[model samples]
Structure formats: structure tokens, C-alpha cells
Target: MATHMTSKKIQNRMKRRVALNKGMSGIFLLATSFGVFILGVLFYQILTEGIPYINLEFLTGKLSTNPDRAGIMGAILGTLWLMAVVIPVTIILGVGTAIYNELYAKQGKLQSIIQTNISNLSGVPSIVYGILGMTIFANMLNLGSVVLAGGLTMSLLVLPIVIVSSQEALRAVPGYLSEASIGLGATKWQTIKNIILPAALPGILTGSILALSRAIGETAPLVVLGIPALLLPFPGGLFDRFTVLPMQIYYWTLDASLVGEYQFLASATIIVLLIMLFILNGTAIVIRNKFQRRY
Candidate 1:
């Protein structure tokens, strides 16, 4: 009788522990749902306020002191120019570094130290990168606040992310593939170009696109570089002074208190920015799904 009673008590305690776990899980789920709910509310607000103001004139017209005539053409051109520079620089350096570290660098204290530093750099604040860019590219190189300067700054900001992601993709490629290529007497560079890169391209491109998207949305670094809000002429070259979509939205939102139309304009710009980010992410997803290898 005594033994039976002890077993029953132990069973009851186990039941209570499971019930507690379930309760905590439900609480966690609710908290996650709340965050999604808040994000949805914000999207709804932006869409409703901004949708009506999006049109050809608003998209194509140059900035104006009069809110009625203002548009985002210069901002759009500047953004394209920045991307033109950012995409190439980031990909070449990022992918190159990833390949070297993953395949060429011997695993040791020095490699470990380099890996740790890269991981830490990935978490550094965007503003810190901006300050560095201002010092190196802007002041030291005397590039000023031009598209080239902004592009280089943003490149540094996203470089670590691209490198980390590329490494992961390369690491995921099967070792057998590389070994077989070597057995076939293929040189390292040829093997990497033909076998490894094709297999890893999906992940590499996905990470690159995401990194570029982050660069596009960033404002703090650009603000630090002192990109102007009112570039009358569209940036036609890398060296031209420029402003981007984020800067336009930021400046307009600030001006909204004084000019009611500025609020709608800001919302419209926000919508465009959202679309740009969506396209970039969607492209990444599509590429990932399309080229993802079984091995």
C-alpha cells in the first residue's frame, strides 16, 4: 500500500510538470503572435495612407519646395547608382573572402581568430560602419558624400553578412564533390569555378540579395556621410552627389508636421521602399528554390 501511494504521487508530479510546460509554451506563442499583429497593423496603416499618393508624377517628378510638385526621381536614380556600385564590390570581395577562408585557409588559431572577428563584425551597428566610411572613404579618400562614397560605406556594412552566408553555403556543398574533382585532376580554381560555385550559387546569391536589401534600407550610415536631401539633378555617375529612398522618407516624415501633404508623400515613399525590399527578397527566394541542389 505504501509503495502504491508513492508511485501515485510521482505520477501526479509528472503530470503537473507537463501541464506547466504546455502553459509556458502557450504564453510564448501568444507573445510571438502579438509581434506579428503589431507588424500587420503598421503595414495596414502605411498602405492605406500611402497608396493613393503613388502615381507617375510623384514617381517621376524632381523634388520641389512645393509639396504639390515633389517627386522621387532623383532619389530613385541615386539608389540605382549606389546599387550599381554596391552589388559588384560586395559580391567580388565577399565571395572571394568566403572561398579563401573556407577552402584555402588552414584551420588553426589564426583562422579561428579571423572567423570570430568576422562574426563579431556582422553584429556591429550600422552607424559604426558609417563613421568608419566617413573617415576612410569620405575624408581619407576624399570621395565626399557621392554615390561612390555611400556605396563603399554600405559595402563595408554588409560585407561580413555576405561572407558568413557564403561560407555557410560553401560548407554545405558535399566534400565528395570537391574530392572527386581533385581525383579527376582538375585544378583548384577550375574545380571551385565549375563544381563548388555552381552548387553553392543558390545560397551565395540569396545571402548577397538579402545583404543588398539591408544596405538599401539603411539610413544611419548615409546620414553620417551627409548625403543631401535635395539633389536637384539626378545622379548620372558614381561620383555624383546623391540621396536615396530612405533619406527622402526620413526628411519628408520630419517635414510632415509642418506640411500635411508631406505625410502622404512619406507614406508613398515608404510603400516604394517596401516594394524594393520585397522584390529583392523575392528574387533571392526564387533563385534559392530554382538552383538549390539535392546534395
Candidate 2:
């Protein structure tokens, strides 16, 4: 009887496992079909409206009244300058804060306050951030809506996001790594800098990519802060006012008069934006995989 009962239990467990595997395959197939459907729709729409307008002139020249003469030179330059400032600052501040919180600080009232505020800041509306930029960076500092002001304002908006992701990445590192470092005669700071940080660098980089992608696609924040969306000459300095791709896309979508032109430009901008996001995400994934193998 005992033998028979044991065999029955084994059979029931096998049946349950087989049923779960069957359900898993069905769920995966549904998810894959949805993803492919969306991707195909997006590809078709972008190709339909964007392919015609994507010429050398549009890619490399200045915005012009000739329509044929217009291009994204200034918008591209502005975006580059924004990223040049925003990325470094965000990484330094956000990752620094995360490292301190996870590897150094103990759970205390102050830590709780900081965590709560950060979580709240992350949920705050993007438009609210725009208003803050306008009031503080632009108005108080009198930066006069230059690229620097716009970038800094956006920097603050994305800082919380970076910090949150960085903290999570750092947290994912096993506590034993730090414990082993401590046992090897390194100070806490040295252990974090040399051992923990290098191990977690890939994850932090992944967060940076996510933050930057958000920055690149943001329009309301730049627009509300008064980025000139139609600059003809490419900006030569960070302090110089500039246009960004999202701002250009927004401006194009504003008027019904330039329907074909606007639709064409919007689709092109979408393609450019998507391509940039894909490259950054791919790089992050590569780094994550590489570092995971290294340590």
C-alpha cells in the first residue's frame, strides 16, 4: 500500500508539472504574437510617412523655409549638447547617491525621509518639472532659456529615476561580496569603490541608458522651458539656445497647414529617436552581459 501511494504521488506531481509547462508555452506564444504585431504596425507606419523625406539635405542641413532646404542640424546639435551635460551629471549624482545609501548608510529617520522624497519625486508630473526649470534655472539664474538651462532642468527631472535604478542595481550585488572584501582588510569605502562598484557598474550603466532615453524623448519639459524649435544655425555652445528632435516633432505636429510636411518630419523624427534608443539599450545590454561574466 505504501509503495502504491508513493507512486500515485509521483504521478500526480508529474502531471502538474506537465500542465504548467503547457500553460507556459501558450502564455509565451500570446505575448510574442502581441509584440510582433505592435512592432510590425510601428514599422509600417514609420516607413510609409518617413522614407520619402529622409534625404541628405534633411539629415545634414539647417531648418529652412524652402522645405527642401530645411533639416535637423540644429536640433541634432542641441540634443548632443544636452546629453553631453546631462548624462555625466546624472550618472555622477544619481549613482553617487545610490552608492552612499546602499553601502554606507544605516536605516535611520533621515534615510527614510530621503527615500520617501525620492519616490515621490519620481512620480511628479513632467510638466511640474518644466515649471521648476523655468522658475529656478531659467528665471532665478537668468539663463534665459538656453540649452544649459534646459539640460539642467531635465537633469533634475531624470535624477530620481537614475538614482532609483542605481540603488536597485547596487542592492542586487550579493552582500557576501562586501563581506569578503571587508575580511580582506579593505575599508568599507575601498571595498565599495574597488569591489562592489566595479561589479555593479554594468547595472548602473543600464540605468543611465534608461534615463537618457527618457531625456531624449521628452518634449513638454523642453517646450515649457522655451526651447526654440526652429533654430536655423546649429548651436555652437551649451549656453546657446537650441532645438531638440522632440521639440521639432512637437512643432511639426502643431499645424494642420503643413500636414504632409509635418507628418513626414514627425515620422522621420520618430525613426531617429527610436534608432537612438535601440542603440543605447543594446549597448547597455552588452555591458550588462560582459560585466556579469567578468566578476
Candidate 3:
């Protein structure tokens, strides 16, 4: 009788555990579905409101005070010019810092402190980076609100993320690969170039692209830097005054109440920005996949 009671208690406990598991699973499924549904709604709204406005003239037009006459071509050109400065500076500085920290720096208190600060920086608000950029790049360096200043500011904003992701990618490369390279009489640089880097390239590219995506969409920093939303001339070079899609969208959205058409214009700019993001992300995925297969 005592043995029978123990068996019954055990079965009851197991049944309760199973019940809890099912409940948690149901909750997770509901959460995921809710997120997906929200995203679907957003996409639907954007497509409906924005697609009608996109056309060849709209694509090739310039910004104007009149909502009907305004085109985002200047903004598009500025965004591309900003990226021209951002990509090289971020990759070079961010990746170089990551390589040094991960491969060369001796693990110590200083290294720990540096790593912790970098992680913290990644979480810092975009606006703070904007202030920093304004003080240093804009005022101190005299770069003003040009594309170079904006690009450098953006580079600083996303640098920590790129560094952290690159470090993680580097760490993920197998220990044996580097060891084997060394055993085969390869130097540190040779080993990194020939083995570790190629192995980690896919992950590095994925992280860098993600960071760049954030930079491209951010409005706060550009706003703080006084990047104009209605530049008449297209940005002809890095030093030229410019505006980006996000800035255009932001200003238009704020002016939408005065001019209802500005709202549609904002949506159209959003559509363009989304298309650029999709293309950028798709290209990154393709390149990363190819490298992943190679490595």
C-alpha cells in the first residue's frame, strides 16, 4: 500500500511537469504569432500607401518645397555618398580593433575593462553618439555637416557592434585551425590571412552588414548633426552637404499635418529605404553564403 502511494505521487509529479511544458510551449507560440501578425500588417500598410507614388520621374526627381514636385534623388545620392565614407572607415577601424583585441592583446584586467566598455558602448543611445559626433567631428575636426562628418559619426555609432561581432566570429573559428597553421610554420599574420580570417569571413560580413543597416536607418544622429532634409543640389562628393532617406522621411512626417500629401511622400521615401535595405541585406547574405560554403 505504501509502495502504491509513492508510485501514484511520482506519476502525479510527472503529469504536472508535462502540463507546465505544454503551457509554456503554447505561450511561446502565441507570442511568435503575434509578432508575425504585427509585421504583416505593417508591410501591408506600407505597400498600399507607398507603391502608387513610386515611378521613374519620382526616382529621378529632386527635393522641392512643393510636395508634388519633391523628389528623393538628392537624398538617395547623399545616402550613397555617406555610405561611401562609412563602409571603408568602419570596416578598417572596426575589424582592425577586433583583430587586435582578439588575437594580439594579452588577456588581462585592461583587456577585460576594454571589452566591457565596448559591450556597454554597443548599448548606448544613438543620440549620445550624435552629440559626440557633433563635438568632435563637426566642431573639433571642422568637418561640419558634410557627408564625411555624418559618415564618421555613423562609423563611431556602429563601431562597437562591429567589433563585438567580429570578435565573436573570430572566437568561433576552431582553435585547431590556427594551431595547425602555426605547426606548419606559418606566422601569426599568415595564419590569420590564410586560415582564421577566411573561416570567420562569413560571420564578420553578416555582423558588419547588420551594423551598417542600423546606421542607414538612424535619424537621431543626423538630426543632431543638422543634416538638412531639403538639400537642393545632389551631394557630388563626400564633403558636400547632404541628406539621407531617414532624414527626409522624418522631416516629411513632421510636416504632414500642414501638408497632407507630405504623409504620402514620407511613405514613398520609406518604401525606397526599405528596398535599399533589402538589397543590401540580400547582397550580404549572398556573399556570406558563398564564403561560408568556401570555408
Question: Which candidate leads in lDDT?
Answer: 1
Clashing pairs in 1: none
Number of clashes found in candidate 1 = 0
Span of ten consecutive residues with least summed lDDT in model 3: 286-295
**lDDT for each residue of candidate 3 in 1-295, tens digit (9 for 90 to 100):** 9999999999999999999999999999999999999999988888888888888887889998988788999999999999998899999999999999999999999999999999999999999999999999999999899999999999999999999999999999999899999999999999999999989999899999989999999999999998988646988998899999999999999999999988888899999999999988997899787988432
Candidate 3: global Cα-lDDT?
0.92
lDDT of 1 at 146: 97
Best by TM-score: 3
Cα lDDT tens digits, model 2, 178-235, are 8999998999889988988887888899888888889988988887898876644788
Q: Poorest 10 consecutive residues of model 1 by lDDT?
A: 226-235
TM-score-wise, the better of 2 and 3 is 3
TM-score of every prediction relative to native = 0.94, 0.87, 0.95
In order, what lDDT does every prediction score?
A: 0.96, 0.85, 0.92
Per-candidate count of clashing residue pairs (backbone under 3 Å)? 0, 0, 0
By TM-score, rank the candidates, best first: 3, 1, 2
lDDT of 1 by residue, 96-152 (tens): 999999999999999999999999999999999999999999999999999999999
